[model samples]
Target: MTEDRPSTVGVLLAGGLARRMGGGDKPMKTIGGRTILERVIAQLAPQCDGLILNANGDPARFAVFGLPVVADTVEGFAGPLAGVLTALDWAAEHRPDVEWVLSAATDCPFLPRDLVERLQRARIAEDAQLAVAASGDQTHPVIGLWNVALRSDLRHALVIEDMRKIDRWTARYKLAKVTWPDKPIDPFFNANTVEDVAKAEQLAALDGA
Candidate 1:
């Protein structure tokens, strides 16, 4: 962790029902001889003070990773926003000292190493309550830094408002957007399907993973 940045806990969002990839844990798929989850962990572990996983169903499946797996506090699969809320609630309960929760999708194998640092810097510079990453004119709402202070509001949005869209909730506050280059290989590139996995295999070599 950087000395100037607030303490952060990384939350790997794996609670989605991967219906597109034949319905299973997408992060468990292997690429470059390693699971996508493994690659995501390698990229984020050094950038966070601690890490937890937001996943539904049996937590024992991810026991090998040795992370505290938290199910969505919201009953049904409420999308990535639910995962974000889970992280916020978990951080508040287990790591009160942590002020931020960095959430990233587990299927994104090549997340930039500077992810947390850059998001923190941008949020502070803009005096924003949240920060998100962008590449090639596209914003990845799921990959961002969340304020742990907003846990209560997020829970209300999830449980009462029935809010499912991440962007809609983020729009309620000041948000910092950080952009990354897409050339060579987009650092935020994700494998969402079998075809994408094949492409990721090739991109992994370029990423030197």
Candidate 2:
């Protein structure tokens, strides 16, 4: 319950079925000899005090990751905003000291290393309610830092207003975007399909040079 790194819990939204790559967990897919989830968790673990995986059913498959598995509070696949909202609830109950929760999808293995620190800095500097990352003029709403206090408002909006896109809720509150240089044009890349997997492998090889 202290304002320390342990207060923040990194939430991995891993419930997606890789429709583009047939119908299975994309996190389980490999690139450059590591599963996407493995690569992502390695980068994410060092940035937070604790971590949890948000996905539906059969959490045993992800047991090797050694993080708690949570399911959506709402039943109908309401999208990433619902996942974010679920994470807020988890943060509230478990990591009470954490004023914010940092979240991202499992498929974005190349997420920035200083992701949590940068988003926190931006939120404080801009005095905003929400903070998300930007790369090469593209804003990633899923990779975000959210104030835990917004849980009630988000729930009300979802339940009553039937809002879906994260941007719609973000727009209602003050938001700040922290842009990362994409000179190599790689910060926000995601591996969503077999082609993307191949491209990511190639990009990683190039980046290692």
Candidate 3:
């Protein structure tokens, strides 16, 4: 990201039910002796001007992390789109100078360092309203760059139309898909199960080296 027009804030989408992981904050699980949320923050904090965490129910559980915990503005847990809308509304109201909000899952420990830079480059180059990250052939819809200008439409989709799927909403606009190599580790690999957490621990060793 360039300093010129790269004014972006970050929103960690932590509001997952985690039924596959036994129903708890999967991000709180440890990998390489650090919480996945910690690892996510470390990777994203430097790349963003500011950061916030999006989680539903008991914001107190995330207080120790020291980032503002935002909940879905729309009712009935409207999925990642609600989280993205929350981020956009927050950024629009609080960070007026920030034009873009980068949304990444909290459970992903190996997020790329160049995520923001590359996403910004792709969106700007393509003159796109949104940009999403992809690893090889897998696209991470929850992890993307959202323009603050679309917050109104997003809120409408979530609250009025009850839209939940991210791709469905993104399909309505110009979207840029930015791809990253899935080499030693996939940057968007998330810990959704106990087995995945174990795998992340092994990958953490590779990452530390």
Quote the positional error of residue 149 for candidate 2 in Å.
Answer: 0.8
Q: How close to the true structure is residue 202 of candidate 3, measured as C-alpha lDDT?
A: 91
> Tens digit of lDDT per residue, candidate 2, span 10-117?
899987766898878989988788898998899988888888899987999999989999988877877787788899999899888788888898998688888888
Candidate order by lDDT, highest to lowest?
Answer: 1, 3, 2
Writing each residue's lDDT as its tens digit, candidate 1 over 1-209 gives: 56557789999999988887988999999999999999999999999999999999999999999999999988888899999998998988999989999999998988998999999999999999999999989999999999999999999998999999999999999999999999889989888888888999999887688
Cα distance off (Å), candidate 1, residue 70? 0.6
Q: Better model by lDDT, 2 or 3?
A: 3
Best by lDDT: 1
Please list all clashing residue pairs in model 1, or write none if there are none.
Answer: none
For all predicted structures, in order, the TM-scores are 0.97, 0.94, 0.96
Per-residue lDDT, model 2, residue 3, is 30
Clashes of each: 0, 1, 0
State which candidate, 1 or 3, has the greater lDDT: 1
What lDDT tens digits, residue by residue, belong to model 3 across residues 81-139? 98999999999899999999999999899999989999998898998999999998999
RMSD of 3: 1.3
RMSD of each: 1.0, 2.0, 1.3
lDDT of each: 0.93, 0.84, 0.91
